[model samples]
Target: MASPIKVCVTGAAGQIGYSLVYMIGSGAVFGADTPVSLHLLDIPPMMPVLNGVCMEIADCALPCVREVVATDDPSVAFKDIDAAFLVGAMPRKEGMERKDLLAANVKIFKVQGQALDQHAKKSVRVLVVGNPANTNALICSQYAPSIPKENFSAMTRLDQNRAQAQIAARLSVPVSDVKNCIIWGNHSGTQFPDVRHATVAGKSVYDAVNDEAWIRGDFITLVQKRGGAVIAARKLSSAMSAAKAACDHMASWWQGTPEGSYVSMGVFSDGSYGTASGVMFSFPVTIKDGKWSIVQGLPIDDFSKGKLEVTGKELCEERDDALAVCSAAQ
Candidate 1:
């Protein structure tokens, strides 16, 4: 086999980090064909816990895990990494406002971005899994000017999977029957899960269900709010499923889109459907050669027009907010 690819993850001590490290190390991700060397980056206070976790991983003795190193410094940890997974972020406490949240995350991503610019291998590709993921990724991309813009993406595949599950359950069909569903806009409560474009097996989802009323009043709302439902049902955050979704997202990114279809991800917009450039937003996209490109020339109806507009506007507002904070800090 060729040399092992080096993958680095930040926030290696959080709940998501725990699941992510194992799955990636276990050959569930990055394929069984390729061995991986892992560099886990955590905060200084969390390194001891990460060290213990590393010891456990050692016990697992996964042949795919060639080496595991834990570090609190990005420069030391990310050097020569092939891909970077940004899974660690500060969660907002009760009563914290969006601006405050953005301020805090921007500080973290800024340093990480600069470090990536300096130390990460020139070819490193990054995926940000932290909250406010799209905006956090935008900050990192802005700081890491040397990296190509297309290399930055935020995790919204969980939103896509939730849309699939909700649609399948309501339509009484398996998730395999659900196809072409698009998650428009950001990965928040305002997200629009459009079934109008979705297909069940080969039939249009709207026609497959044959009930526009249910699609309107229930499907979109359910998919958009499913995260809250999971938290309510499990009494804990959605980490395991989120980890699975991350695996799916990267899998699809490296693999080509299915024969004639696409998926959605938070990619840097190019003014499509009135979304501004340089800001990342979710759109129907396909991956070719490990790069995601938004599908062009799709027909957008009046319904999609409104849905995309609402989410697209929210992204612009948040982008401006993040930029204003950066200005004030300077």
Candidate 2:
């Protein structure tokens, strides 16, 4: 076997972490041939829970999990790690403003980002899965100046997968048939799930479904609101699907996507498509050699342009809010 790669997962005792760790150990994130050592991190209060999780993982006899280190220290957990999943963050409760939530998570990510800068491999790939994820990712990347900005991304594959499933259902075809489904902008309710460039079994989604009305109206809203729908029906946020999407996000980034297709990842923008720099915005990107390049020259009609602008403005405002919060703390 090859040398084991260290994989660190924050919030290792939480719902998504529980599902995610198992998947990683089972070779869902990395390839089955690659050996992996898991470094699981959680708050001090969750130590006992994290220990039990580690024990269960041990009991699973997963060969990929060569070694496991469960800790409350970010530096210890992140040390020399190859991939870090920033899944832990403050969850918004009843009546909390989005800005307040962003403020609360800023300190956490800032500390973790500093730890990553000091301890992790320079090439480490970090994915922020916490809520207000796009802005939170920006905060994390800001602190880790030594790490390349492209190495840090927020999860938008969940939104993309949701879009793919919805379109496939509408077209009465298997989800696997859906291709090039793009999720633009934020991961929240304002996300634009566009299937304009998508296809189902070699046919354009528009031609296959022939329902422009639903695609422009209910489909977009449904894709954006699926998270809330899950919370309402289950009394808890999505765990399994979220974990699966995180796995897909990492796997696809590590192993390149299809030749003509792309996946949505919230990465730091360099003023692409008129989005301001420094914000982690979601765009359709193709991966090659473990690096993602944004897809260019896609036709964005006036309506799509308007929606993109709305999400971009929201992200910029959130970035300002997080910066103010960080400044206040200093």
Candidate 3:
């Protein structure tokens, strides 16, 4: 067997992390042939819960999991890691302003990013899953100057999956039949779930659904607000689906997306599609040999262009707020 790759997940005791750890243990993110040394991190107060999670993983006897490390220290958890799921962050409280929440998370990610820079493998792949993810990712990458900006990405695969599922349901086709449903800009409600270039079982989505009005209206809103809808129904944020999407994200990153296909990831923008540079923005990206490139040359209609502008503006504002917070700390 090949040497076990070191994988770390922060917030390993939380709902999403609970589900995510099991998936990783089962070789969902990495291939079944590859063994993984799992490093699970949570806050000191949550160590008991994290320990219990480790115990459960031991009980499962998953062949892919070679060893497990549970710790409260970011340095310990990040040491020599090959990849990480940065799932922990300060959530927005009921009365807290957006800038306040950003300030709180900026502290969290800044510390973790330093840990990654000091201890993790130079080629470590990092995925930031916490809310305000695009800006949080930008913060994390900024603090880890040793790591390539391309190695850092925020999760927008969840949004893309939601878009594909909605399209499939609308067409009454299997979800697998949906392809290339792109998520443009931030992961927030301003994201544009563009189906303009999507195909449904070898036919154009527009040709298959025959409802441009619904596609431009309800479909976009539903995918954008699906997280809130889930929270309303379950009285909890999305965990199971979020875990699955994270797995899909890492797996695609590890093993390249199939030829002629792509997925959405919030990566450092290189001014693609007129987005601001240095901000983490979601775009349709294809992975190959463990590297991702933005899909180029997709024609953007006026409506899609306007939607991109909205989300891009939101991200820029968030990035500025986060930078102000970081500057204040220094």
Candidate 4:
């Protein structure tokens, strides 16, 4: 057996973390052939809950989990870790402003970024799963100056999965048949769930559906608002699906995406596809050897271009807001 790879999950007591940790422990993220030492972290008040989670993990006796450590200390959770799922963040209250939420999360991620820089492996792969994830990832990368920006990414795979599933259901085809469904820009409502290049069983999605009105109207709107719809139906935010998407993301990042296919990931923008240079933006990406590169040369129609611009603007605004919060604290 390979040496145990150290993995960390923040907010391990939360619903998503509860689902995600079991996946990671069962070798869902890193695979069954490799063993993992799981490090779980949450707030001080959540430690007891975290400990109960650890007990359940031990009771499961997952063969891939060689060890388990539950704690409230970021330093302990992060130390020499190979991968981190940063799922913990301050949830937005009913009356709270967006800027106020950003301010609170910026403080959290900044400290975590510093922890990652000081203690985690140089090659540590960090995925920010918290709300306002793109800007939070940007803040994390900024604070962890010693860690390469490429190592930090926010979860957009959930949005991509939602788009793909919606397309599959509309076409009455298995979800596995949907391919190349692109989720562009922010994970928020401004996100563009583009199927211009998507296909169902090798047929163009446009032709498969043959309804331009639905594709451009209901299809797009539904995918963009799916999270809200989920929350409305369940009276809680998405957890099971979100956990699955997070697993899909890390697994692809670790193992590599299939050839001739791309997935959406919120990575630090290098001005690709006319996006602004320093914000975290989601783009169709292909992975190889644990590295991700933005897919290039997809001709964006005017409509798609406009959608991209709107989401890009929102991300830039968020980046600016997070930076202002940081500056204020200093």
Candidate 5:
């Protein structure tokens, strides 16, 4: 058998990391067919917590995991990594200044990007899962100039999955029956869940429901606000579901996307679908080999265009913030 692929995850002691380590170690994300070795990295203070999680991995005795190592150093953790999931960021706490938080996370990501460029396997794929993931990913991609732009992505698959679930619930149809659901723009409140591209049971979603008011009012709000809803209901941030989306995002990107179907993923924009260049945003994408490419030839109605621009504008703002902050620092 060839050597196991090395999977590195930052922030491996936190809630999402707690959920993700086991899944990745067991080959749940990549599949049992591919053996994996996990490199779990966390901050210094979280080393004890990571040790506890590592003990659990030992007890589980997952054969797919050739080895599991926990560390505090990004350089050591990312060494020879084949795939990396960057889930670490300075989250918003009470009274934290936005600039300060962005600066802190940028510092972390800059070092990570450098380490990945120096030590990871050639063509290593990166997924940023933390808050403000788009800009953080941009920082990493910029710092790691050697890595291909498409190899670094942010997590918008969460927004996409939520969009699909809400659409299925509205029409009282199975989620698998909802086809070609699209989410455009940022992963925040402004993200647009475009049902214009959706078909339920081979019928257009608008034709099935025929309620313009519902689509504009409740449906859009539900998908846009779903992350906050999950936090409110669970009394904690959405972790497992977020991890699941991360899994799906990479799985679809690494494996081939099915024919005639595409998924939403956040990748560096090259002006595709009229998205602004240098801004990272979610687009309807088809993956082949190991890269995600925007699906071509989809008609964008006026409503969808407005939504896309709204979210796209926010993404450009994030890019501006990064450039401004990094420029000042330089």
Candidate 6:
């Protein structure tokens, strides 16, 4: 049997954390055969809530969960961790601009990243799930100089999953039938849900539907704005779906994405597709041996290229905005 892995989750008392911890404890993130030691972290004020969460996790009595540690300190939470999920950040409030939101979260990620560098295993994989996640991940990576840049990622699988569901519903097919729904650029309204290379059960989605108008119009907008739509309807941000997407993101990273299949993930851009370096941008990626490589050489039409340009610009601007905050702090 493989040795137990340490998994740390920040914001353990929050909605998404509440939704994700059980799945992680039940071997959803890793595998049923592997044991995990969970480290739950939150702010001091939320310690009581985190303690209750730990109690519930224990009550589940999962065979795969070996130990649970609840703490309010980054040093304790990140100590020798194998996988760390950076899920806690300040949410965007009424009238707050995206730059303002980025400023608010950058400091949090910087501190956490330093803690990870100081305490976590050198091979630790980090996923940033909080809002403005791509930039938050970038900030975290900046602080963790010893950790590989490839080890840090942000959550864009939620957007990809939403895109797949929209396409599946349109074609009256099972969601599992949809493949290669790529989410490009940031995890924001500007994200491009590209279906140019997508397939539905081994057939090209373009030839299956052939509705360029709807694909360019409603399909893209729906995937990009789905988070806002969910908030509007539920009067709360998407907790369950977001948590499930995080699980999917980590699981796919650990267990290889299927052959010839890919998922969109927010990884550091290495000048791929002309995207700027050091920014965490969502691109279609395949995982093998617990590492992700960007899918290369996919055809980009004029429409998709234009959307990529817009989203790429947005991500660069966000990177700059967050970097400015870091500089100001110094």
Q: Please, what are the lDDT tens digits per residue for candidate 2 over residues 105-206?
A: 988998898899999999999999988889889999889999999999999999999999988888788999999999888888788999999999988998
Q: Indicate whether candidate 1 or candidate 3 has the larger TM-score.
A: 3
- Model 5 spans > 4 angstroms off: 92-101
**Candidate 6 structure lDDT:** 0.91
In angstroms, the error of model 4 at 329 is: 1.2
Error of model 4, residue 95, in angstroms? 7.2
Per-residue lDDT of model 5, residues 28-136, tens digit only: 6777878898999999999999999999989999888888889999888999888999998766553444456567787778788889888887689999988778878
lDDT of 4 by residue, 9-86 (tens): 998899899999999988888988799999999999998898899889999989999999999989999999999999
Which pairs clash (backbone N, Cα, C closer than 3 Å) in model 5? none
C-alpha TM-score for every candidate: 0.95, 0.98, 0.97, 0.97, 0.94, 0.98
The residue-level lDDT of candidate 5 at 296 comes to: 79
Error of 2 at 18 (Å): 0.5
Off-target runs (Cα >4 Å) in candidate 1 are 92-97
* TM-score between model 4 and native: 0.97
After superposition, candidate 3 runs with Cα above 4 Å error = 92-100
lDDT of 2 at 253: 88
Question: Can you write out model 3's per-residue Cα lDDT over 73-151, one digit (the tens) per residue?
Answer: 9989999999999998765444445567677888789888889999999899999998788899999999999999999
- Model 6 clash pairs? none
* Cα lDDT tens digits for candidate 1, 1-330: 879989898988887888888888887768877899999999999988999889988998888999888999898888998888898888644445556767788778877888999998878878888878889999888889998888888888898888888778877888988987888888876788877778888988888788888787788888877777776777666788888887777768766688778888889999987766777898889888887778888788887788888888778888888887777877
RMSD of each: 1.7, 1.0, 1.2, 1.2, 1.8, 1.1
